[model samples]
Target: MLWETSPNSTCLHAQREAFIADVNRIQADAELANARAQLRLPSSRSLVASTKEGKFVAMTSPARLAVSVLVISGCRRHEPAPPLIRPVQTTVIRYGTAGEPVSLSGLVQAQNQTSLAFRIGGRLIDRRVSVGDTVSPGQLVARIESQDAKNTLSSAEADLASAQATLVQARSNEARYRSLLSTDVIPREKYEDAQRQLAAAQSRVAAAMASVRTARDNVGYTDLHSNVAGAVTAKGAEPGEVVQAGQMVLQVAQKGGKDAVFNVPATLMRQSPKPPPVSVALADDPTITAMGHVREVSPQADPATGTYVVKVGLDNPPDTMRLGSTVIGSVTLSPQPVASIPGTALIQIDGKPAVWVVDPATSAVVAQPVNVVRYDSASVIISSGLKNGDVIVTAGVHALRPGQQVKLSPPAT
Candidate 1:
């Protein structure tokens, strides 16, 4: 070091000594902090300068300046890091009585279905209508062999004509016998016999006329006619097939009304006894829809499946709701007070259902046991263990632990 000093050298020397004193004070403070914190810091004793130096110089010594910088750096106090806060999504619970809407797959059917059958047993000669064919009232749907019926009708007519001729002859004979009795030419017993013969002939003619009418009806029965305007949904017998009396030949679905038939699970049917109006729509095309009320429900569950058949009669259904078309029926149950939460929030603890609930005061989560009333695809119906204003964790539930600190994300816009 070199000293180029003129007068006032004493003042410069005093300033240098004061700077050294400040550095020494900082070093003492660092040492005290290390002892109190029990931290194993690097020794700062080596950086302490001697109280006396040999001579005053114009420029400071590099070794002494390095010591001052080290002493200043060591004076900083160490602080512990802040606690970890995990960000999670949460939702508030709101209790309400709105039950979830349930949808069922079903088939569109006629409200009034009729099965056309032959009135008498015979070989089916002709089937004029097939499946999906439309027919009007009194339209000929099918025909059975009618040769026997026609022959019976002809025989009845012949008997009727014979009885009529006999009745005429008996009346003439009775009139002639009465005139003879008046002239005392015939006995009274003979006149009574003629009257009895006339009565017998009249009764026979009436019976024969009845037989003719019956035979004619039998012939007409061979040709099956549609009594209602509808479309043929099915065909039971083909041409040349022998069918019995009252055996179905064709099934017609009446055109005026339609029904949506559904096989509903027993659980759902039990939940809502008097179900509200159902909304029915085509399965393939949703735009075609109709409102319906439950018209009938099967008394017993199906043997194959534990479900009840529900028939919903549609009001003024569209033309597209053809018989046998696939449809979807939705039944909205009446409302009941129940709380709903997202399905992701549910967890199992000790084989029981639970959820992670947030503590507003501490911003921590705890596992809460909840009574689940029902389960939906995306949410759960909670009947107990949750109340209004309770906040629950929705996502990342598996990763969370009891009493874990959390920061809630802002609600979605």
Candidate 2:
């Protein structure tokens, strides 16, 4: 260092040293900035940086944010989630003190139904009435051919006339014979013969008279008459059709009384109390209702339908309720204690019949299995698994779950 050196070499050495010192100073500054960042605590709004693929991503929350940086340098964001609240409808179930009424579909029919037929065999030459035609008592409804009948009557009349003439001649001979016997002008045997002849002729006349009356009656049998005032319900024979004796020709429904005929189950028939009052209503017009009583119940059940035939007699039924009209009959039975709920409230949970019961305090629902006693058109009778004063979800049952919170809507007025 004491040795004298060239000016150019000295200048080059100084420049190299200065460059080394500047590199050290930059290194030290980078270290100091990293240390300061590590010492500071993270705040709520602090930004966290993560490296994914080859790019950096910044997120607000470390626990909730999932950052996935694209290899091509892009960002994707997701919005916050909202709370879940379901709206539903509920109903308060109560036990029915008045038992459920049984309703059955039936047909309105005349109480007196008769089948009209001919008494004698003949060709049906005329039919005066058709189905639904009104007829009165002693009204001629139909007639058969009268040619043969008339001929028979004529022959009987001629026989009767001949017998009458013979009888008169015989009586005259008997009188003459009796006068001769009294005067001893005729033998006793001859008088007895004359008396026998008169007796035989009188018997012949009596027999002929009976034949004539029978012939007259036979002729009358060719005509068909209605014995009651009614409407024809059916026609079995047509004009010019030959029908046998006692063959049904028409069906007439007599006027005066109406009956509601219903086919009821055997259980209902057995359980029905004595003198149960039945109420009947027209299927089309329910407002036209009539009070009636049980008229007749079939002792046997129908094999095909397994139901008993029941006839209910209407008291003073209106004329508007025509024959063969559809009707509905309702009968009230003895009161029974049973829990009843709407059919809509029924559901299936865990492969069992169930309903949703709501907790009043928590407004949560739980699926409760129930013993179904009977199912009706709009309601159901529960035998067990349910009690009175229990709140049940009637509507929106399919969208509910156990322990799920719900907001109930106001009940319908």
On TM-score, the leading prediction is 1
**What are the per-model C-alpha RMSD values against the true structure?**
18.1, 17.7
Lowest lDDT 10-mer window, candidate 2? 67-76
Model 2 per-residue lDDT tens digits across residues 266-355: 766765778899999999999999999999989889999999999999999987788999999998756667777889989987788899
Q: lDDT of each structure? A: 0.83, 0.81
Poorest stretch of ten by lDDT in candidate 1: 48-57
Tell me the number of clashing residue pairs for each predicted model: 1, 0
- Candidate 2 TM-score, C-alpha based: 0.58
Q: After superposition, how far is residue 292 of candidate 1 from its true place, in Å?
A: 2.8
Per-model TM against the reference: 0.59, 0.58
lDDT of 1 by residue, 240-299 (tens): 889999888999888777889999887778677485789999999999999999999999
Task: Give stretches of model 1 more than 4 Å off.
Answer: 1-96, 273-275, 298-306, 337-413
